[model samples]
Target: VLVASFAHFCSFDRCNSASSSSVLLNALPRPADPAPGHLQCPTCVTVFGSCPQNSDIVTCPNGTSHCYNGHIAIRGGGISSSMNIQGCVAKPSSFLLNHTQNIGVFTVMENRNQGDERGEDWNNPIIQAGAAPVSAPFLAWVVGLGLSLALWGGAPSLPVLYWSGPCPHWTS
Candidate 1:
């Protein structure tokens, strides 16, 4: 009976520690900006920053720019600037729950059991497909290879073939 009780206490302690750790990790002080500057953004939490390549960015469809602290900036159809983050906790003045009524809720279920009944799980499908994952190095390699092949290796490399009417030399 004592052993069972100790085991139960240990499990409870583990659970509590796990919950506290998650809360701490999620609520850790966000990184601070290197310098102070006028920040323009819709929300504090929506800061932009460097993300791994292939990370998705959902943006405004129209032409206006959305600037946020710690978020990378999209300019002229591409990413132009890195995000400078200044960590600060924001407090709402009042408890306003009605504003979220319009938002929809979705439920996610986690399967904790390690069972063979589950199908194959793919964390990253693109890797399995043999496609490039869009890292900076991979992108550079692709671009360099494409440029070299387009300019040197193929038929386009021969200037004579461009005119192609059987006259060889240039005239004045």
Candidate 2:
């Protein structure tokens, strides 16, 4: 009877151990490069007036193997503005690369993420898309107005003139 009970207990122990080992394996981080020829990196998109406030992970297109982040300034038509952008770019032989367009120039600064040392989970969604762009001219106007008002000695008010004559409703 003792031997039979001991065998039953051992079987139960083995079953529990196998289940726990599987759970631990699932919890462990997967290998960084699960597939070949595909590069994944952080991406951010910002229009000159409407820039993204944060970065997120994105899979790079074929032939592009580097992540880029920086600002682009555009000046013309009496309007000057700038935008911040980040995304995949063709791997360059040098650290920084500049490309000029008809409207403006794009400056790229490489952002490297390897060995997962940066502690960034590229699989998760970092930032939302379609962020509204702030109006530069509107902001400038508000600041200028505020400064003019301040220098003008507070808000304007009308004088409280009082009449010396008796009230029309009063009788002598």
Candidate 3:
């Protein structure tokens, strides 16, 4: 089974709405972190395996325009594993894809291109390594539906798999 890793928000000094001391507040302005908002996306990072169905939704940073989903496979020595990432990005990135490289961590091979590693004859996949076969849109839809069902009395008996407070930016 794939385990989904969730990052929970912890408050820091800046997260506090008002500083206790008026003198301290007057001296230097402390910039506040962006407030959590509705631009939410499923966030998870799974190391060397598939991710879980119940991922935590989080608010994206101010400039983020797209939700990113990526998979990276690593193979070298006796180790053969992959990493999965899903989060918000400022923009959509074009996948480098099927090409391979030796830059380390069994590097290269980025992108979401179709086709295979070698060719039709070799029959190797270029996209969706590891647990990514589930497709991002489908995954998001499933998660959204579950959340709605759990919260809107659609399924009052259905428990929320994971719940957290206001979703801060990527940091949390």
Global lDDT scores for all candidate models:
0.19, 0.30, 0.35
How displaced is residue 170 in candidate 1, in Å? 72
Candidate 1: how large is its RMSD? Answer: 29.2
Q: Please identify model 2 stretches exceeding 4 Å from their true place.
A: 1-37, 48-54, 93-98, 101-172
Q: Please give, for residues 5-121, the per-residue lDDT of candidate 1 as tens digits.
A: 001123322232221122322332333222222211111111233323233212111222222112222222111222221111112111112122111121111111121112112
Ranking by lDDT: 3, 2, 1
lDDT of 2: 0.30
Best by lDDT: 3
Candidate 2: tens digits of C-alpha lDDT, residues 1-172: 0000001123332232221122322333332332222444444434444334344444444555545445545444333445344444455322222342442221223233332222223333223347432211100000000111111122321111111211111111
Residues 74-165 of candidate 3 have per-residue lDDT tens digits of 45433454555555544445232324454332343434322222221111212223534322221221111011111122222111122132
Per-model RMSD to reference: 29.2, 32.6, 17.5
Model 1 segments beyond 4 Å from truth? 1-16, 21-30, 44-172
State every prediction's TM-score relative to the real structure. Answer: 0.15, 0.33, 0.38
